[model samples]
Target: MIDIDPNGTGLPGIDQLRVIVGAVMTVGLILAVLALIIAAIVWGFGANSSNPHLASRGKSGVLIACGAAIICGAAVTLTNFFWNVGQAI
Candidate 1:
């Protein structure tokens, strides 16, 4: 039987890497939410101005922001899943 440490896999700097990844994820999520908000505002303005091209751009921006949010939200789950896979190997 093999034992794995939840904190690390007996590798140096793994903990620091984890911390850096977590910080990046947090910042990414914050930026994604801000982008979503800005997209919504732009969409509103475009709609009010009757600019289809601007509205479409805003819509695409909103979609991209939502996608970023989804990825960021799933970061922990994805990390855990990969961590477990590594442990099994």
Candidate 2:
């Protein structure tokens, strides 16, 4: 048989989990933005400027650009997700 708490005392448990989940999402978005900035810097160093050794870094930058794009997408998604969750309350 399924069990249910007679007095609905489970709120604290549920509330704590939501708080933690929200904190995790906030951290994730922050890290994702930082990674995007780092990737942009790498891509910029690779694609722009006139130095020869810096030229070799272009490929790495292009890869970094791709990574930044992906992280940006993830950040957008996470922001929307958290926004929606917040609105639901």
Q: State TM-scores per candidate.
A: 0.76, 0.46
As a whole number from 0 to 100, the lDDT of residue 42 in candidate 2 is: 62
Error in Å for residue 57 of model 1: 0.9
Best by lDDT: 1
Question: Model 2, residue 76: displacement in angstroms?
Answer: 12
lDDT of 1 by residue, 1-89 (tens): 76747656678889889899989999999999999999988888899999998898899999999999999999789989998898777
Task: Indicate the residue-level lDDT of 1 in model 1.
Answer: 75
Q: Please give me the total number of clashing residue pairs in predicted model 2.
A: 0
**Least accurate stretch of 10 residues (summed lDDT) in model 1?**
1-10
Q: List candidate 1 segments past 4 Å from native.
A: 1-9, 79-89
Candidate 2, 1-89: lDDT as tens digits? 55443344555687677678778767765675666567566656755776556655655655665565566557658877887797666
Error of 2 at 81 (Å): 11
Clashing pairs in 1: none
Number of backbone-clashing residue pairs for each candidate, in the order shown: 0, 0
